[model samples]
Target chain A: MKRKFLRRVVSGLLVLSVVAAAFTGCGSASASENSSKDSDSASYRTLDEIKESGTINIGVFSDKSPFGYVDENGDYAGYDVYLAEQIGKDLGVKINYVSTEAANRIEYLQTGKVDIILANFTVTEERAQEVDFANPYMNVALGVVSPENAVVTSLDDLKDDDEVIVISGTTAETYLTKNYPNIKLQKYDAYAEAKTAFENGNGVAWANDNTEVIAFANENPGYKVGIASLGEQDTIAPAVTKGNETLLKWLNEELETLGSQQFFHKDYEETLLDTYGADYEETLVVEGTK
Target chain B: MDFNVINEYIPLYKNALLLTLKIGWQGILVSLFIGLIGSAILYFRIKILKTFIGIYIEIFRNTPLLVQLFFIYFALPKIGIVLSAEVCGTLGLGLLGGAYMIETIRSGLESIPVIQRESAASLGLNEMQSLWHVILPQAISVSVPGLLANVIFLLKETSVFSTISLMDLMFTAKDLIGMYAKTIEALFLLVVFYLIMLLPISILGTILERRMRYGQFGD
Candidate 1:
């Protein structure tokens, strides 16, 4: 009896070890091959289900501010939180805000960890193929910031070994990799990590949305937006799953009506006004909500 | 699907593997030294020394290792007990490993028959001589297997030391994962690295245990 028990235990342990190895293999494959099967098989919960559940999980950055971030008192308070609240009220459901980083937003949405992603997710052709965008509430472009005196008009100026830091899932990563293949990237999943990594000489410059880079430059001395803009103006949107037609139709119609009145543009002016200030009004502002 | 991802991180994996081995060997060695000293407190039945070992074992075993590592690495600087990351990590690991080791080695020593000590007493061998010549050699041979097992445990425990920015195996893997977005590859490399350290120790323990079970009395 004793021998049998030990044999069972050992066999059980072997099975567990094999299972862990399998999970590790599966996860490794999925990590590198992100977005391959993502577009075709992404699951979408219907608008009615969201309403009946009485709660919508919206993924947003808890470490970022002026969009979504946790305050000193351990409460979630940001422009995105306020917007999410209003959207929740509009839909007559509770809002469950899931703290997310740039890298995990797509995964969180794909895995049904969130009903919508409003985490400053830039609308791009590559991303649009996977998750449907609900028209941009904000327009942005990739930008880089270095020390105040450093002037860089193009990415070619960066040394081959020198790195441009960016949050992992942000457009800056995509833009830099696509446009300037030679530049090394120091990527962090969180904004705070990228900021610290850049400040610690891990990278020569940090790039993100112009608004964020501008904010970084304004807050820190000896830093300026060296590369003020890159690529076309990209839109920031609230993304949902691809095939949820009811939610997709409702979101498009609501956004068009909202765009006509320009509620989001005013919200941006109110929420993002401090980050941009009057000096950045011309280049950074997307006057129309759409 | 590309194996290039694993190939690219080979340097990181190698560095991590070596660091883990370095820390793992040192941790177990320091722990063995401490366990020997600590078990003496329990073995000799010294009234005051027993209390001190009890306190030490309680303090180290009860407190969280992360907190202990933080106390050594960060808090010690305030009190002017500043130590290097390597020193602090090793010391923290030793203290934690010692708590468990003391019990293990002590139990191995205790498993000896009481009549053996009576035989030593009759031979005019004093307490210290008997302990050194008769008890310890047997205790160590029996205890070697358990101590080997804890060496594996200590190696695994070194993962907690990563938070101090020591760039141990897990830390290096995390850095690679951040760069490549291939968490699986990074973790797999770490798993393999850890297994290489542990599997040999485990196999050695099995052999030692079998040898001790049979050869313990010496024909």
Candidate 2:
């Protein structure tokens, strides 16, 4: 009798667990559908709406150094972060830094998680379809970094066994997969992991933004930026959710206004000068859009 | 929501599912081997090896698998112990699952009545023979359910293989979502593929558990 009761209780628990799993699975699917429907109507806070809240959430990469990264003081401090602060000041609102990875930048905007993305976000025609890009703030292109011993000077130099390390969702990954389909690419989700993997010799070389690889080679000894530029030159810009006309317009005007003062140049000198030096200042910094 | 995208992703998902299963089964086999050995050490009350196995269990059980994988893949290479991502994933899953398996099998071993050992000895069996013919069979039968649960658990834990860049199912799903932004379709297919992998094992586990509960196997 006791054994039978035990079996019954066990079966009951299993059934309950199965039902719970089914419910959770359906629940999430429906929830995401609802979110997508809501997004279709444009679920972004406008400029005045952001001011009304007194705080604007700006997504930035806490790991991408010199562009968007946390400083030694635990505060967000970088080229893009400096721009974010100025935008916050101009809008008369506080800035809430939301650390984001490259893969989730569009999702963050579409989900109403951030008012702006300033994490060295490169503007491409494809990305523009999902998020509205503001005027250019910086210039960037893909670059490869490798150890001093076996530097990857060109894509053809990579042999069959040579794997190139790339951070997922970056333009570098897209470019390589498109252009060099035969190259074996080891993709990491985070910048830090890719850097670590590269350092550990997991891959023959690392490909990323020219600014990033150049900065990495400069900062870390025994590494060199061998293919200083791989793809077409692209401009970095702040992004807002699609259909966020008010916020998008405000950002463009603000960037143009800042251009008069050479704000991004100042941002470069203050935040990126240490990593990139004065020689790259003019070439890397874009003072608003043409 | 997007059937077309799901249809498009089936081939990629198929390849990723195979990789996941390959790593999952390899890890399970390693854990089973480790668990049996560790539990046997404790069963026989081996002096130094028992203490070592006990510490191994405690350390692996206490730490998260992600940290372990990171250490093996990234940190260990700093100290001249380099492991590939695939090796690190299999080893991490095996080590973590082995810890739980050791405890599970130990409980089953201890649950064997003392008289069972004595009866085997009285029947002219030596210590090893008694353990081999009597104690282990009963203990393993009692342990089928727990072992199956651990197998399922280790399989689920393969989701973390993406962190080390192993190209598992979760990695494929995340990569698809990242590349296309077809979040709904990617996630829907992810759920379906996981169900395909896990549901059969789950149902089989239930049947095995029922059989063991009624003592049908040993008899």
Candidate 3:
């Protein structure tokens, strides 16, 4: 009996030590990896390296329509996806589309999970410090959509209890939190959830990119874009890993060249024209920073 | 790595932690109540209610909490059953957890020897008395470990409450990360807060489990 007790205690200590060691090992390994990623672009592939690899991973939203969404045919089809295809063609590499969310766009680039982020990513000074933004390709601003029965026309109209639905990590969330602190915000991690919540009357209005809310209103009747432009106009651009100058320069030059050919115009015509019609083409398309 | 950001977010995390604990405790209580009732119904071999509970267990156990939450918060309103996010969160967690708790407690109840029940009945104890005095203590002793595990799981599952927009710990972390891109700081705070919330429960559970074990074996 004494021997059995000692053996049990000894084995228990061994198991506990093993678990502790495993946890510490994981913590240190991840810490080192994150630190290295922050200081340098060693993990990210260079433009030449990407070309040689013959495949480029481009992050795009798989839910936001007219921008980056999977179509009924189950293929990635949208404005950003169209640009990505053109990029793949110019770079002479096959495109590997990684579906990303609004929040993880920077993380995807920093972690070398994708070569570029074209997920309707709005350029902000804070985000630019973390990820290198290429030249602008489109124009965007915050917009709010609400049910026709109770349209939320202005920011001041939202009372304390009236929650405004916004997707996590989008410009809308930031804008509302900063400018209208009194308005309660209901945030969802995904666009689909936000839309569903809005439709279910969980929130009085849904705030998102003007392009997204506009498209949403066009696609789904009984809702209207009550606030077409809520905050400062921002440009949507491709983002690469910070300090990945080779890819960044290549993207800028590509955008500048693509501008001369009106590439974004064609992309808009193909992907966004049905939703926005012809009038929005000039306002929405940036065409290589010009 | 960034102590400043962590310090700045402490108040936010503190609020988030409270909401998380509130929901976690409420959900656990609900699960216990449901688990006890369902197990009793099964132990007595009640016919129709037993079948109904069996189906409930299978449905909640088979489906993910995220889906159930979406159904409760988003889908149900269409059928004229609207619930607030907090209510939906608690209900979803309780329903999902009750399923697992029932299975855990049922196994414990089944582990009690038939002779124990017969012996209680022969000793002038009624059915309720047999269950209350004789069967439950031994069955609960066996169940302590599994129930504790389920408790921990249900607490962790409260992380999903963020999906329904309940401003739980996970939502605060993700919101901070989204707004500021402070990945390391936000996630570090998230880990600390969750540990703060869960570790005490885990320690207390171990103590209770050890005490119960000592009582059962006298070792």
Candidate 4:
């Protein structure tokens, strides 16, 4: 009798838990559908719509510097942030900067949390399926860095037994997985922890955009960017939610005009040149409008 | 879009889950050893070891595991104490679990009536034999439940080690989410994975505690 009662109780609890998980699943689906319906048809509000609304939500990284970072004074300051300020001025709309990570860039735009992601967002074919991308403002190279002793000079040199460390969601993860399928990968989500792991010999090398590689190699004397450039030229571009043709057109047009003025090249010289030194200016610079 | 893709990724996820359990099991063994040995130290009231134990317990108990993990992962490597993520994770848990077990078992030891010890002394048993034969046997019943709960907590925390490339379940889930941008599916599955690991031990701990509560040990 006691065994039967306990069985019933256990079965009842299992049923309750299944129902609870089902309820949560439904809740999330409804939430996702609600967000899609609310934002999909609303689409691009255009420059006039933004000026009328009085603010443009510009998403940028709060950690990456010379691109987007929180300054010592708690103000958002970076090359992209400087451009955001100018864009706001030209449109006569207030700019509301939203801090975003590489992982959340597409989702931020898709859900209408931000009008655009300018957070050093490297353009990739996989990401393009979800968001509309503007003309490239800058060209980025892929690079790998390792401890001074275990330098990874090229993809060819890395042994099959070795694992490459990566910040998941970055262009590097996509490139490495596609290009070096046999090379094992030890992935981390956050920059800080990944850096710590790399320093502690968690992996043979760390791969990321060349800009980030340069930053790490310069800051940490014990490490070097042994593979200075890994793949074909990759571009960093502004992006908005897919199907937002009006916004994409405006951005592309502005980018063309910005290219003629050599605005992005100048932006790189002023902000990135000092961090990178003068050697990279002509080689790495890509002035707006791909 | 392809749910079938999960089949391809299953090996990675399964490997990660197994690693987590392995690390958790090792941590539990270390915790058991530490608890047993620490209780002996405290029960015997050793000279300097008691003082050191007090300090160690207070320090670990007062601080956060996240801070401890950061220190072990980063600071140790700085001073040339290089260890892999898996080793660093197990050692960190062992150290923290030892400190926690010290306090837990101390309480269980104290709860044992002194009358039994006095009677044992009269029966010509030395202090060491008295503690071994009398105190510990009874205390193990009480200690098992807390240690089991601690094991569960340690299992969950193995996820943090994933941040340092420990290849645990949470780490795999994060990797998949990053790869596919399928946040909801990955996160829900991770919670289910954790529940599966923790629930059986929790039920076993409860059963053990109840059995210990029967007439002979109840008083």
Candidate 5:
């Protein structure tokens, strides 16, 4: 009788666990449907509504250095963060910074998790179809960095057996996968991991935005941006949710107004000057006057 | 909601599921080997080797698998030893899973009654013979349930290998999400895929546990 009871209990628990897993799976399915419906049905808050609420949600990277990164004091501080603060100040609302990764920027906007994304988001035609990108504030392009001892200067320089390091979900990954199908690529999920992997000689070179690779090469002694441009030049801009015309217009106006004040130049001085030096200040900063 | 999105990515998901299973089984085998070695060292109570095994268990168990993976894949290269991402992931999982396996097998060895050893000695069996011909067989049988349970745990733990870019199930899910932006569909499929892999192992564990219990007390 005891053995029968034990078997019954075991079977019962197994059934219960199976039920729980199915429930969770279905629950998430419904949850996403609800969220999508919520987004479709007047879910977005307007600029005026945000101003009235006295808060604006801004998404920025907490890991990507010199653009958006957490400082030693654990506060988010970077070029993008500096611009976010300026936007918050100008709009007269408290900024609530939401930390985001590269891959989740559009999702964050679509889900209304953040009102704007300032996460070194490069404006691409494909992305523009999903999110409304504001006027460009900075220029960027894909670049490759390798160890000084054996710098990868061009696509041809890479051996057939050599692998290039890329962060998953980045343009560099997409670019290289499309262009250099024959080359092996070692993709990492995070910038820190990719950096470490590159340092460890896991790949012949690391590919990322020129701004990032430049900064990385400048900071790390033995690395250089050998292939300084791998793909078409692009501009980094803040993106608002699709059909957020009011926010998009306001951001454009703000960028134009900030341009007259040379705000991006000042932003460069404050955040990027130490890293990129003065020469790149003119080339990298977008005036946004147009 | 859009089941079509998941249906569309079936091919990608299938490939990723295969990779995940490949890594999961390889990790299990490697960890089992390490576990057997670790348990044997502790079973014999080798003085210096015991300390080293203790340190190995403590370090791998005390730290996170993600950090250990990062160390092997990223940090070790700074000192000159470079390994592929999959190799680093498997090694990390093996080391971590082995730590837990050691304790499980140790308890199994411990549960073998002292009388068995005494009987072996009386039967004129030496230490090696007793361990080889007598103690290990029973102890390993006792350990079967725990070791299988650990294998299941390690199977799930292989998801963490995605961080190092092993193209496992979770990484494929992330890649799908990145491509399609259908977070729920990708995640639900990921959960279902994991269930497909894990449910069988869990059922096996239960059967082994029941069988081992029956063998132990003859209910």
Candidate 6:
């Protein structure tokens, strides 16, 4: 009798789990169907629509510091946030900041989840093919950092067994994998974990955006950005959906107008001065005058 | 419904599934050891050890597993003790799983009739001998189902290790999504992988429970 009762309970659990999995499976099936339909429809907001609605959804990173991050009070505050706020003001719309990660930025734009991406989106040919990019706002390149005692100044300095820390999906990972396939990589999904892994001595060097490593070395003592630049120079720009021509045109004009007023320099002074100091002010900030 | 992308990534998924199983099994073994020791301490009601165990269980049980993992993998490095991501993830899962196991096993011990202990005492069995020879066997028989269920729960919980960069199954799926931007395909594959791992374990648990019940009740 006891055995019978136990068997019944087990079977019941099995049925319930199967039912749950089926429900989730069906849900995802429909979501994918919808995403494919959305891609065909090109259903994204225009400048007039956004202005009429009085709101623009801008995607920014909530975890990446200096570029974008949540402040101590749990509000979004960063260089990208400052720039996004300006775009909202110039467009005469209230800002609705949508938190996005590095990997999801393109998807967010494609799905109409956000009208613009300002999350330190580095311009690459592959990404540009999928989305429309406005004029560049800042310049960035990959850098490597390590402990001050055992600095890694270049890829050549790394030993065969040494592992380099990289955040998955970032340009650093792609650059190293394609260019320097000899070096081993320990990939982390998030910036915080990658930093921690580096601190734990799990890897010999941490490679990421030059601005990020500079900020990290400044924040954490005993670390230094030994290799300040390691890849092709790239520009960070605002990206719109594939066919968002009106919004893209507006952004380009806005950037050109902002350049006359030195808007980017003011933005840096307000959001990034403390972390990067004056040394990088001229090199990193782009006026977009052209 | 572009399953072709998923099919292309099957080899990567398979490798990730193996890593997930490896980490899950290691966590299970470590948790079982911790659970047995913890439950035994509680069953005997040791003086100071009980209080320490009580606090330990409460802290681990109440806090989120991700926070514990992050603390171990990230925060501990500041104090000079640094462990690999795999070790930190496994240790985190073991500690958390052990806390729940202790309570589940304790409840199993409570369900056993008081007369069994009294009879053992009268039959020349000392406290330790009675616990070992009589009480533990019965308690374990009763607790097999709960323990197995916990094992299944811990298996799923191992996905959280991906946050600490352990390259488990979830991390592989995330990597695929990051690469291809195919959210649904990657998520669907992840669910399928988890089901493949979990279903057999649940079925085995049921089998074990039925056998134990039949052995105990003589039906």
Residue A108 of model 3, lDDT score: 85
Give the per-residue lDDT digits (tens) of candidate 6, residues A47-72.
88889999999999898888899999
Best by DockQ: 6
Q: Write the per-residue lDDT of candidate 2 for residues A93-181, one digit (tens) a residue.
A: 99999999988888899779999999889988878877899999889999999999888899998899999998888899888888999
lDDT of 4 by residue, A1-290 (tens): 35644775596569558855774775577466646744346644555567689999999988787678888999998778867777777777888999886666767876678888888888877788778899888778898999897788877887778889988778888888888889888877667777777877788899988888888899889899998888888888889877667677888888888778988777877777768888877776666646
TM, every model? 0.68, 0.91, 0.92, 0.86, 0.86, 0.87
What's the lDDT for candidate 1? 0.74
RMSD of each: 6.4, 4.1, 3.7, 3.7, 4.0, 3.9
- Per-residue error for A64 in candidate 1, Å, reads 3.4
**Full-model lDDT for every candidate:** 0.74, 0.87, 0.87, 0.77, 0.84, 0.84
* Docking model 4 quality class: acceptable
Q: Which residue pairs collide in model 4, if any?
A: none
- Show where candidate 2 strays beyond 4 Å: A1-42, B213-219
TM-score of chain B of 1: 0.93
Question: Taking the tens digit of each residue's C-alpha lDDT, what string does model 6 give over B1-219?
Answer: 466877987788898888888878888888888888888899889989999989999999999988999899888888988887778877998898889888888888888899999999999999899988888888888999889988988888887877787777888777666655666678777877777788778766767887888767864
Which residue ranges in model 3 land beyond 4 Å of their true spot? A1-41
Of candidate 4 chain B, the 10-residue stretch with the lowest lDDT total is B1-10
Model 1 reproduces a share of the real contacts of 0.05
Off by over 4 Å in 6: A1-43, A71-75, A218-221, A277-279, B1-4
Question: Which pairs of residues have clashing backbones in candidate 5?
Answer: none
Which stretches of model 4 miss by more than 4 angstroms?
A1-58, A72-74, A87-100, A104-115, A147-150, A219-223, A241-257, B215-219
Residue A276 miss distance in model 5 (angstroms):
2.5
Candidate 2, lDDT over the whole model? 0.87
Q: Which residue pairs clash in candidate 6?
A: none
Task: Compose the digit string of candidate 4's lDDT tens values, residues B27-115.
Answer: 77787688778878989999899888888888877877767878888788888898777777787788788888887888888888999
Give native contacts recovered, as a fraction, per prediction.
Answer: 0.05, 0.28, 0.38, 0.29, 0.29, 0.28
Alpha-carbon deviation at A186 in model 6, angstroms = 2.2
**Model 5 lDDT per residue over A1-290, tens place:** 45655675677567667865775677676577656744344546789989999999999999998999999999999999999999999999999999987777778887789999999998887688678899999999999999999988898777888988888777887788778888887767778778877776678889999999999999999998998987898899999988788899999999999998999999999999999999999879998754
